[model samples]
Target: MSSYEEIASPADLHADCQAVSHRLQEAAVRATRPAPSIHFDERRREVPKRGIEISEAAQRLANALHLHLD
Candidate 1:
């Protein structure tokens, strides 16, 4: 059977270490960079007016409930 040293020589290990270090440096640089800014419109979003009108009975009931709560 082949030994561990034979499978991965010193040169191979050094190259692997260099590749890993380079990747880590790239990741660190990406992490340090600021994220892009997102802007929201200053105007308020207009909600669609409800098409259905409340019945007179519902309005009276709501008024009664409001008076009771007050």
Candidate 2:
């Protein structure tokens, strides 16, 4: 960090600085995603209306999934 300390104990100061550096390194590692990932049309997330006519194939698929999960 640009903003840091001016303390006495150099050994403890080195340990503290190493701890901070290690934390920053771990944070950098975590802030990444896998190469092959999927994204969707986020706008199409609303629940379907009551009378929306799902196709027979879609209905069968949904029912199969629902039955298995339950």
Candidate 3:
């Protein structure tokens, strides 16, 4: 059997992987935190209105095209 060369020990490799994983987790959490300038409350309030507007537009288009949708 041929012998393999050593790069990093199993323990050392495990520690390095854990450190990298922790850093990635931290970065992901920071990225998802909302921006200061965005008005999330206002946007949430507008959701229903936007849905209604879209529905009205679709209905108007269907009427124009003479498509019978029950």
Q: Which candidate is the best by lDDT?
A: 1
Candidate 1 lDDT score at position 27? 100
Estimate TM-scores for all models: 0.49, 0.38, 0.45
lDDT of 2 by residue, 1-70 (tens): 4444555488998999999999999988888745643556644678888876667777788788885322
Tens digits of lDDT, candidate 3, 1-70 = 4365657889999999999999999999999998776766656554444433347677788888997443
TM-score quality measure for candidate 2: 0.38
Candidate 1: list runs displaced more than 4 Å: 2-6, 40-70
What local lDDT score does residue 7 receive in model 3, on the 0 to 100 scale?
Answer: 72
How would the candidate models be sorted by lDDT, starting from the highest?
1, 3, 2
Error of 2 at 41 (Å): 13
Which of the two candidates, 1 or 2, achieves a greater TM-score against the reference?
Answer: 1
lDDT (Cα atoms) of all candidates against the true structure:
0.80, 0.74, 0.78
> Residue 35, candidate 3: how far off, in angstroms?
0.6
RMSD of each: 13.8, 15.1, 9.6
